[model samples]
Each structure stands twice: as structure tokens, then as C-alpha cells.
Target chain A: AQTVTQSQPEMSVQEAETVTLSCTYDTSENNYYLFWYKQPPSRQMILVIRQEAYKQQNATENRFSVNFQKAAKSFSLKISDSQLGDTAMYFCAFVTSNTDKLIFGTGTRLQVFP
Target chain B: SAVISQKPSRDICQRGTSLTIQCQVDSQVTMMFWYRQQPGQSLTLIATANQGSEATYESGFVIDKFPISRPNLTFSTLTVSNMSPEDSSIYLCSVEVRGAAGNTIYFGEGSWLTVV
Candidate 1:
């Protein structure tokens, strides 16, 4: 079985600043995918970014980026220039190649303050 | 990215009554899934909606309690039977689209059900 662990329960960052959310997963399979999703009060699940296991280069989407370490099984999300709109619940997810089922972490509530 | 839509965005239902939520995708997809998210919690997989077949539910969920139907490749419905206060949560419909990046999962707006 695969499991995703998010150490941070809550996080806060000032507007225009940066915050990094930590995520780690345990999986024996070599081929898998990691993802970060944001859910605001609207109850919508928005995909922030994703990283493929085979890709050595980290994934970046504008202000959002991931630091993926395959050997350590660590995938951290860094949001630069955080804005008030970034205030939401962020979840880290892992999925293997064999199945499309996504294993999600407990989630970290992020609050961006002015 | 596939555009997913869910009906009954939010509803208040009575206990013991059943509510069915519909999901529609803009394009054909091979995989569709249903998820449940409690207040202030992460999303949990409820079942996998396969086209032209029965849905495969996850642990702690049953077919009688949460029956799902996927009539075609682009549509599915999930019915919650005998609702309770504990069933007051957000039900999300998701689909997987394989791209160069990988198999990415996209979700619908979600249906918020409050059982009173």
C-alpha cells in the first residue's frame, strides 16, 4: 500500500512572501506521480502542479514549483509571491502507474495574510 | 484538461432520504472517480466509475449505501442512500486525462450535501 504524509497541519505567509509545504510518500513502485491540489472555500479541487517519477527536473507552474527527490521520496511545494487568494487547504497526492487511484495526505491549511 | 460538471451543487436533504448527484465530462475519458471530502478534511476516494460497468468502491464503502452508475464514457451518477448528518460533506467527481506530463486528475465543482 502507498501512503502520503504531510507534516504541516497549518501554515501562514505574508503577502508577496514565499512558503514551502512539505510532503513525503512511501511506495515500493518505481513509476508513480505526485501532485499538489488546492481547495478553497468554494469546495473546488484545483490542480496546482504535478511531477512524474521519471522526470529528474522538478515541475514548475508560474509561481508554484515542486522540489522532488526520488531517492528520499520527498516532494515539496513552494509557492512564491503568495497572494491572499492562496489561502486555502492544500493537499498532497500520490498515484502509481498501475492504478489511477490517488492517495491524498491529510492536507495543510494555508492562510496568506497581508 | 477535461471540463467536469456536477449537478446539485449544494443541497439539504432529510435523514433516510437518498440523493443522487450527476457528473458530466466535456470529453470522453477512460477513468472517472467519486470522492468524499468532509469539512476541514482531505478528499477520500469513494469509488471508481467505469464506463458500461459497475463501479468499484473503496474500503469502508458499500454498493448498497453508495450506489454508482456509469452509463457511458462521459457521464456517471452517484446515489447516497439513507443519508445522515455524518453524510454532510462535499462529493466530488473527477476524471483522469493522460498527457505528456502524466495521468492528471481533474475534478468537478463538487456537490455539497447536508443531511439534516
Candidate 2:
């Protein structure tokens, strides 16, 4: 069984600033994928960024990036130049190569204050 | 990227009733998944729907409670049978699409069911 943990229940960031949301997971599988999903007020789940466990380099998507430390079992999401639209509930997810089922964290409620 | 749509975006049902949610995809897919998101919580996989076969359920889920149907590649349906307050959660339909690195899962808007 695999589990994802998001220690921070809530977080706040000032507009135009940067914010980092922490995430950790426990999985025995070597080949896996990590993802960060954003659910806005509209209740639409949007993919923020994803990182492959085999990749040493972090994944960056415009303003969203991930700091993936495979040895530490840590995958954190960083939002740079944050805007009000970034305010949402962020969830960290894990999926193994064998089974495509996703395991998600509790989520971090992020508020981008102007 | 494929577009997934779920019907009856939301509904209020009485206990002991059943609600069947429909999911349609723009492209053909091999696997379709159903998930449940409780209020203020993360998503949990309910079952995996595959065309031409019975659905595979997760540990805590059973076919009697959540009956799923996948008659083809681009469509599936999930029915919440004998609903209760505990079943009042957001039901989402998802499909995996191949991405640059690997497969990425995309979710529908979700069907919000409120049982009283």
C-alpha cells in the first residue's frame, strides 16, 4: 500500500510572491509518478505539474515546479510569481507503473492574498 | 488530451434511492476509473471500468454498492445503489492519457450527489 502526506493543512501567499507546498509519500515501488493537482473554487481538478521518479531533474511547468527527492521520498510543489488565481486546494498524488490507480494526499488549502 | 463530460453535474437524492451518473469521453480509451471525493477531502478510487469485462473494484468498494458499466471505449456509467448520507460525495470519472513522460489521468467535472 502507498500513502501520500501533505503536512500543511492550509497555506497563504502574497500576490506576486512564491510559495512552496510540501508533500511526502511511502511507496515500495521503484517506478512511479508524482503529481500535483489544483482544485479551484469551480471544483475542477487541474494538473499542476508532474515528476517521474526516475528523472533526476525536477519538473517545471511555467510557474509551477516540483522539487522531487526520490531518496527522501519527498515531492514538493513550488508556485512562483503567484497570483490570485493560484488560490485553490492543492493535492499531491502518487501512481505506480504497474497500477495506474492514484493515491492522493489530504490536500493543502492555499490562499493567495492580494 | 481528451475531453470528459459527466451528466447530472449535481443532484439531491433521498436515502434508499439510486443515482446513475454517465461519463462520456471525446476519444477512445482503454481504461476508465471512478473515484469518490468526500466533502473537503481528497479523491479515492472506487473502481476501474474496462470495456467488454466486469469492473474491478478497490478494497473498500464492492460491485453491489457501486455498479459500473463500460460498454465501449469512450463511455461508462457508475451507479450508486441504495444511497445513504455517507454516499453523498462527489463522484468523478477519469481516463488515462499518454503524456510526454508517461500516462496522465484526467478527471471529469464530477457529479455531486447529496443524500438526505
Candidate 3:
């Protein structure tokens, strides 16, 4: 069974600053995928970014990037030039190549202050 | 990205009752998924709804408890049978969309269920 762990329960960053959310997972499969999702007060889950295990280059989407260390099973999300709209509960997810299911981490609440 | 909508955005139901939530997508999709998010907890996948096939449920979930229907490529429904207080949570429906990274998933606003 694969399990995702988000160490930080909460995080806050000032506008235009940077913040990083830590996530780790336990899995035996070499081929898999990792994702970061944002859920605002509206309760809509939106994908922030995704990283494939086979790719050595980390995934970056505008102000969001991930530090994916496959050997250590660590995938951290870094948000730069944070804006107030970025304030939300961020979740890290893991998906294996074999199944359509995705295992999610506990989640971290991010507050971007103006 | 696919725009998804869920019906009965929220409802308060008595224990032992059943609630059916509908999920409609703006465009045809390959798959739909039902998930549960308990208070202050991570999202837990309940089942995968595939058109023309019986929904595949995850461990700890069963067809009897959470019956699903995917009549077409753009719509699906999930029913929580014999609901209890423990079942109080937000039920979300999602669709897998094509993206640069292969398949990307998007979710609806979710139907909040409170069983008392």
C-alpha cells in the first residue's frame, strides 16, 4: 500500500514571498506520478502541478515548482511570488502506473498574507 | 480541463436515509471518480465510475454502500446508502482530463452531506 505524508500542518507566506510544503510517500513501484492540488474555501480541488517519476527534471508551473527526490521519496512544492489567491489547503498526491487511484497526503493549509 | 458540476451542493439527512449526488461534466471524459473528504482530512477515493462498466470501489468501500452509475461519458451519480453520522463529509466528483502530463484530474465544488 502507498501512503503520502505531509509534515507541515500549516504554513503562511507574505505576498510576493516564497514558501515550500513538504511531502513524502511510501511506495515500492518505480514508475509512478506525483501531484499537488489546491482546495480553496469553495471546496473545489484544483491541480497545481504534476511530476512523472521517470523524469529527472522537476515540474514547474508558473509560480509553483516541485523538488522531486525519487530515491528519498520526497516531493516538496515551492510557491514563489505568492499571492493572496494562493491561500488554501494544499494536498500532495501519489499515483502508481498500475492503477487509476491516487493516494493523498494529510494536507497543509497555506495562508498568503497581503 | 473539464468543468464539473455536482447537484444538491449540500444537504442534511437523517441517519439510515440515502442521498444521491449527481456529477455532470462539460465535455466527454474517459473516467469519473467519487471521493470523500472528512472534516480536516485528506481526500479518500470511494470508487471509479467508468462508462458501460460497473464502478470499481476502493478498499473499505463497497458497491452496496456506495452505488454508482455512469450512464454516459459526461455524467455520473453516486448514492450513499443507509447513511450514518460517520458518513458526514463532503462528497466530490471528478473527471480525468487530457493534459501535457497525460491524464489530469479535476473536481467539482463537492456536495456537503451532514447526517444526523
Candidate 4:
């Protein structure tokens, strides 16, 4: 069984600054996928970014990027140029190549203060 | 990316009652999933709805408790049977799309159920 862990329960970032949310997982599969999802107060889950384990380079999408360390099973999400709209609960998820089911971690509630 | 829609965005029901949430996708998908998110918690997979077959439930979930219906590739429904206060949570519908790297899952705006 694969499990994702998000250590931070809540985080706050000033507008125009950057913040990083830490995540770690335990999995035996060599090839898998890591994802960061954002859920606003509206309860709409949005995909932030995705990283493939086979890729050495991390994944970046606009202001959202991931620091993926496969050897340590660590995948952290970084949000740059943060805005008020970034206030949401962020979740780290893992999915193996063989199974499409996503194993999610407890989310981190992020507040972007203006 | 697929556009997914869920009906009865939020509902408050009495205990012992049932609520059925409908999910519709704009495009056909190979896999549809149901999830539950309790207050201040993450998403937990309830079951995988397979077209033309019975839904596969995860551990701690039962078909009788969460009856799912998948009539086609683009539609599914999840009914919470004999609801209780513990069943007050947000139910989400998701779809998986095959991509170059792997399958990318998209979620619909969750249906919030409040059992009073």
C-alpha cells in the first residue's frame, strides 16, 4: 500500500512571496506519478502540477513547481509570486503505473495574505 | 482535460434518508471514480465505477452503503444509503484520461452532504 504524507497542516505566505509545502510518500513501485492538487473554499479540486518518477527534472507549471527527490521519496510543491487566489488546501497524491487510483495525503491549508 | 459536472452541489438531509449525486462528463472516459472528503481531511477513494460492470469498492467501503451506477462512459451516480451524521462529507466524482506520461485524473466540484 502506498501512502502520502504532508507534514504541514497549515501555511501562510505573503502576497508576491514564495512558499513551499513538503510531502513524502512510501511506495515500492519504481515507476509512478506524483501530483499536487489545490482545493479552494469552493471545494473544487484543481490539478497544480505533476511529476514522473522516471524523469530527473522536476515539473514546473507557471508559478507552481515540484521538487521531486525520488531516492528519498520526497515531493514538495513550490508556489512563486503567490497571490491571494492561491489560498486553498493543497494535497499531495501518488499513483502507481499499474493502478489509476490516487492515494492522497492530508492537505495543507495555505493562506496567501495580501 | 475533461469537463465534469455533479448535480445537487450541496444538500442537507435528515438522518436515515438517502441522497443520490449525479456526475456527468463532457467526453467519454475509461475510468470513473468516487471519493469522500471529510471535514479538514483529504480525499478517500470510495469505489471505481466501471462501465457495463459492477463497481469495485475500496477497503472499508461497501456496495450496499454506497450504491454506484455507471450506465455509460460519460455518466455515473453514487447514492449514499441510510445516511447518518458520520456520512456528512463532500462526495466527489473523478475521471481518468490516458496521457503520454500516465493517466491524469480530473475531479468535479464535490457535492457537499450534510446530515442533520
Candidate 5:
């Protein structure tokens, strides 16, 4: 069974500051994928970033980037120069190549204070 | 990137009634997924629908409760039958977009339902 864990239930960051959300997963498969998704108050989910297990280089999208440690089984999302609009619930997800099913962690509520 | 749209963005239904949420994607996709998100909780996958086969439901979810229909590559529907207060949730639709690197799942805005 593959399970994703996000220890942080809530996080706060000042505007223009940085914050990192930690995520870890347990999976026996070598080939898999990790993702970060953002859900705003409007109840719409947006894809933050994704990292493939085989790729040594981490994935980055604008101010959102991931530090993917495959051996350590850790994948964390780092938000640089955070803005007020970044306040939302962040969820870490896992998906294996064999099964397209995506398993999600509990979630970390992020609040960016101005 | 595909544009995914869901109908009845929000609705308040009486208990024991059934509601069918429709999902439409601009581009053809092989796999369409249905997910449920309870209030203040993470998203849980309800089932996965393939165009030609029966839907595959996750462990706790059954076909009778969440009956899914995938008539074509670009359209799918999920019906919540005999709804209750516990069934009040945001039902989301997702599609697998195969890219050069790998397959990425994109989500729709979601249909929020409140059972009273």
C-alpha cells in the first residue's frame, strides 16, 4: 500500500517570505510520481507542481518548486516570495506508473499574511 | 492542457434524492476520474472510468452509491444516489493528460453539493 504523509496541519508565512511544506511517502515501487495541489477557498483545485521519481532534477513552476528526495522518500514544496493569493490548502499526492490511481495526503492549510 | 467543465457548480438537494454531475473535457482522454472531498478534508478518489469498460471504484466506495458512466472519450458522469448528509461534498472530475514526461491528472472546478 502506498501512503502519503504531511505532518504539517497548518502553516503561516509573511508576504514575500518563503515557506516549505514537508511530505513523505511509503511505496515499494521504484517508478512513481509526486504532486502538489492547491485548493483555494473557492473550492477549485489547481496543480502546483509535479516531480517524477526517475528525474534527478526537481520540478519548478514560477515561485513554486519541489525538493524531491527519492532515496529518502521525501518530497517537499517550497514557495518563494509568497503572496496573499497563495493562502490555501496544500495537498501532497502520490501515483504509481502501474496504477494511475492518485493517493492524497491529509493536507496542510497555508496562510500568507500581508 | 485540456479544459474540463462540470455542470451544476453548486446545488442543495433534499435527503434521499439523487444527483448526477456531468463532466466534459475539451480534448479526448483515456481515463476519467471521479473524486469526493468532504468538508475541510482531502480529496478521495471515488472511481476511475474508462471509455469501453466498467468503472473501477476505490475501497470504501461502491458502484451502487456512485454509479459512473463514460460514454465517450471526452465525457463522463457520476451519479450520487440516495444522498444523505454525509454525502454532502464537492464532487470533482479529473482527466489524465499524457505528456512527454509522464501522465498528469488535471482537475475540474468541482460540483459542490449540500444535502439537507
Candidate 6:
């Protein structure tokens, strides 16, 4: 069984600053995928970024990027030039090699202060 | 990226009653999934909604409790039968979009169910 862990329960970032949310997962599969998702008050889950284990390069999407360390089983999300809209519940997930099912972390509630 | 929608964005159901949550995707998809998110908890996958076939449930989930229907490639439904307060949670519908690896999953605006 694969499990994702998000150590931080809540986080706050000042507008225009950057913040990083930490994530770690335990899996036996050599090839897998990692993902970060954002859920606003609307309860709509939106994909932030994705990283493949085989890729040595990190994944970047606009202000959202991931620091993926496959050796450490660590995948973290970094939000740069943070805005108020970035305030939401962020979840880290792990997808196994065999199944499409995603194992999600407890989540971290982010607040961007202006 | 698939644009997915879930019907009855929210509902208040009485205990012992049942509610069916509908998921509709803008385009056809090969896989649809159902998930449950309890308050302050992570998303837990309920089952895989296989088009034209019966759903594949995860551990701790059963067909009798969460009956799912995937009549076609573009739509699916999940019903929570014999609802109770324990079943009160945000139900989410998701689809897998083909990506570089295989398929990336996306979720809909969850349907919040409040049972009392």
C-alpha cells in the first residue's frame, strides 16, 4: 500500500512571496507519479502540477513547481509570486504503478495574506 | 484537461434515505472514479467506474453501500444507499486524462452531502 504524507497542517504566505509545502510518500513501485492538487472553498479540486519518477527534472507550471527527489521519496510544491487566489487547501498525492488510484495526503490549508 | 461537472452540488438527506450523485464529462473518458472526502481528511477513492461494466471498489468499500453506474464513456453516477451521518461527506467525481505518464486524474466540484 502506498501512502502520502503532508506534515504541515496549515501554512501562510505573504502576497508576492513564495511558500513551499512538503510531501513524502512510501511505495514499493519503482515507476510512479506524483501530483499536487488545490481545492478552494468551492470544493473543486484542481490539478496544480505533476511529476514523473523517471524524470530527473522537476515539473513547473507557471508559479507552481515541484521539487521532486525520487531518492528521498520527497515531492514538494513551491508557489512563487504568490497571490491571494493561491489560498486554498493543497494536497499531495501518489499514484502507484499498478493502479490508477491516487493516495492523497491529509492536506495543508494555505492562506495568502495581503 | 477534461471539464467535469457533478449534479446536486449539495444536498441534505435524511438518515436511511439515499442520494445519487451524477458525473458528466465534457468529452469521453476511459475511466471515471468516485471519491469521498471527510471533513479535514484526505480524499479516499471509493471505486473505479468502468464504462459498460460494473464498478471496481476499493478496500473498505462495497457495492451495496455505494452503487455506481457508468452507462457510457462520458457519464457516471454514484449512489449512497442507506445514508447515515457517517456517510455525510463531500462526494467527488473524477476522470483520468491521458498524460505523459499514463493518465492524470481530475476531480469535479464535490457534492456535499449532509445527513441528519
Cα lDDT tens digits, model 2, B49-86, are 98999999999999999999999999999999999999
Q: Please list the residue runs of candidate 6 whose C-alpha ends up more than 4 Å from where it truly belongs after superposition.
A: none
Candidate 1 per-residue C-alpha lDDT over A17-108 given as tens digits, one digit per residue, 9 for 90 to 100: 99999999999999998999999989899999999999999999999999999999999999999999999999999889998899999999
Ten-residue segment with the worst summed lDDT in candidate 4 chain B? B96-105
Whole-model lDDT values for every prediction: 0.95, 0.93, 0.92, 0.95, 0.94, 0.93
Tell me the tens digit of each residue's lDDT in model 4 across B35-87.
Answer: 99998888999999999999999999999999999999999999999999999
Worst 10 residues of 5 chain B by lDDT: B96-105
Across residues A6-72, which tens digit of lDDT does each residue of candidate 6 receive? Answer: 9999999999999999999999998788999999999899999988888999999999999999989
By lDDT rank, best first, the candidates go 1, 4, 5, 2, 6, 3
Once fitted onto the true fold, the runs of candidate 5 whose alpha carbons sit more than 4 angstroms away are none
Ranked by DockQ, the better of candidates 1 and 3 is 1
CAPRI quality level assigned to candidate 5 from its DockQ score:
high
Candidate 1 on B36-88: residue-level lDDT in tens? 99887888999999888889999999999999999998999999999999999
Candidate 2 per-residue lDDT over residues A45-82, each given as its tens digit: 88888888989999999999999999999999999999
Q: DockQ for model 5?
A: 0.83
Q: Which interface RMSD values do the candidates have, in the order shown?
A: 0.7, 0.9, 1.1, 0.8, 0.7, 0.9
Clashing pairs in 1: none
For candidate 5, write residues B1-116 as lDDT tens digits.
77999988999999999999999999999979999999988999999987977899989999999999999999999999999999999999998888898978889999999999
lDDT of 5: 0.94
Computed on C-alpha atoms, the DockQ of candidate 6 is 0.81
What C-alpha RMSD separates each model from the true structure? Answer: 0.8, 1.1, 1.6, 0.9, 0.8, 1.2
lDDT digits (tens) for residues A62-88 of candidate 4: 999999999999999999999999999
